[model samples]
Target: MNSNHPPTPRTLPTAAAADVPTFGCVVYISTLPDGRKKGRVANLDGIEHTAGTEREVLQRIVPVFKKRVSECLAAGDSVPWIDPILEIDPQEQKRFLPVHL
Candidate 1:
């Protein structure tokens, strides 16, 4: 190895790299009775966050959802992923969020 040259970066094996998982879930946003926006994960029961706006609700929920996924993976439990296609009421809005650890 030449002292003036930088070392080449090594790539991880495909399978090994894939082991570090990426999680995704569907968040459904709906207006509450009092007009606040509520963001609820489609597959995680009781996992919800509320804020004054759609953007704020999403910002609040993503971290909480990521933490839950991290905890599950740390404990060797399966993450609760949302379905590819979820049926929702017409009044609700939805978005798919990917959680990368």
Candidate 2:
């Protein structure tokens, strides 16, 4: 979903600034506007920014993208980023693929 551009770090959900993960840089998430339950997927690097209408694709992944980041931090990983869920623009939210290197 994302493009060949750098991620603009805007204000986080709470903190003024946080650290983005190491290898878990990019992320792709989706939502089930129809409200149908489904499975989801994320790379080992914790990058999930896209989804399909499959059992594993799981569309309602948007509301939890930040949670996923939190989980990685809970696992004792150095997540050098913050949850910027509040600043996610609906139009810009679609570009979540092709993470930045």
Q: What is the C-alpha RMSD of each candidate to the true structure, in Å?
A: 5.4, 17.3
lDDT of 1 by residue, 65-99 (tens): 88888888889998766555456778898888877
**Number of the top-ranking candidate, with lDDT as the measure:** 1
Q: What is the C-alpha lDDT profile of model 2 across 50-77, one tens digit per residue?
A: 4444334433444355565567668988
Please identify model 1 stretches exceeding 4 Å from their true place: 1-20, 82-86
So what's the TM-score on candidate 2?
Answer: 0.24
**What's the C-alpha lDDT at position 51 in model 1?**
91
| Clash pairs, model 1 backbone | none
